[model samples]
Target: MKTLGLIGGMSAESTAVYYREINRLVRERLGGLHSAALILWSVDFAPIAAWQAKDDWDATGRALAEAARRLEAAGAEAIVICANTMHINAPQVQAATAIPLIHIADATAAALTARGVARPLLLATRYTMEKPFYRDRLAALGLPSLIPDAADRDRLQAIIFDELVKGVITPDSKAAALAMIDRGRAAGADGVIFGCTEIGLLIDPAELDLPAVDTAIVHCEAAVDFALG
Candidate 1:
């Protein structure tokens, strides 16, 4: 199996989920005696988050690029960034690494297209939705993505940064999150994407009435395939 390199700890909230899903997938596939072939490089999310919020693309890209290079040197077969928002700098990071940087957007785009979801609602950080990087990539794949309205975006940002990013998940927050997702569904979206990596903390497929896409899970699925397949 190839080693899965994780550039994780972006918010730490969803990094845990990524690690768990990868291990779970490996165990389920290999059965009973297996953990993932994994190498993890945990980043200090606060500093990175601050830089991202400032739109400091240079510093943000530098941080991820450094991580990618180190992970490559550490012998990761392929690297996956653990956060959705951090992919804003993925181009620079991928260039810094020798191995493939498994991208969440690409994985999700392929999944949604395969599932016949041409127009999906995207629920992520403002940087992810408003920025054209991810959305343009989806467009290139002949898929469409919709961001939440201003009010819903603010709500999602709060749930992600103020609560989920801090490792806090509550029943009330979960309900509010599902409510926002419903709003997106009502907007004529075929399915809603848990585009914020940390969203797995507060929501799940079973909890929602609409079809859902989990980007972190999608990315992990791709990583596991590359590893054990």
Candidate 2:
């Protein structure tokens, strides 16, 4: 198996999930006693979060590129930025390394396509929702995106940063997220993309009637595929 490098800790909460899921998937695919060859570089989310809040993507990109370089130097054959929002820096990271950077949006788009979803509601950070980076990727795959309205977008952003990222999952927050999904359904979304990595921690796919794309799992599976291939 190839070594999979991860740029994580955009929020340790969801990064932990990525770590677990990747290992679990490897073990399941390869059978007993088999696990992935992995290298993880967990960064301080404080400064990264600050850069995101300020919309200072240049600084974020520089930091992520440096991280990717370090991982590449350590012999990682493929890179996975373990958070969806951090994918804004994916191109920069890819430019800094010879190894592949498995993009979260592209992975999610592929999953949505396999599930036959054309228009999925995207629930993520304010940056991800407001920016064209993610939506454009989906559009490139012939899948248009449906986002929550302005007010709902603000609420989702706050919930992700303030509550979900911090590992505080409450019934009220889950209810609020479900309500947003309902609104998206009303607005004609055929499915939902838990575009924020932390969102899967809040919304369970089995509980939802609509098909949901959990980006963390999708990205993890893609990394595993590349590693095994």
The prediction achieving the highest lDDT against the true structure is 2
lDDT of 1 at 140: 92
**Per-residue lDDT for 77-171 in model 1, tens only?**
89899988888898898899778888898899888877778789988988898999988888898878888888878877887888888988898
The residue pairs found clashing in candidate 1 are none
TM values, all candidates = 0.95, 0.99
Q: What lDDT score goes with residue 217 in model 1?
A: 91
For each candidate, what is the lDDT?
0.86, 0.92
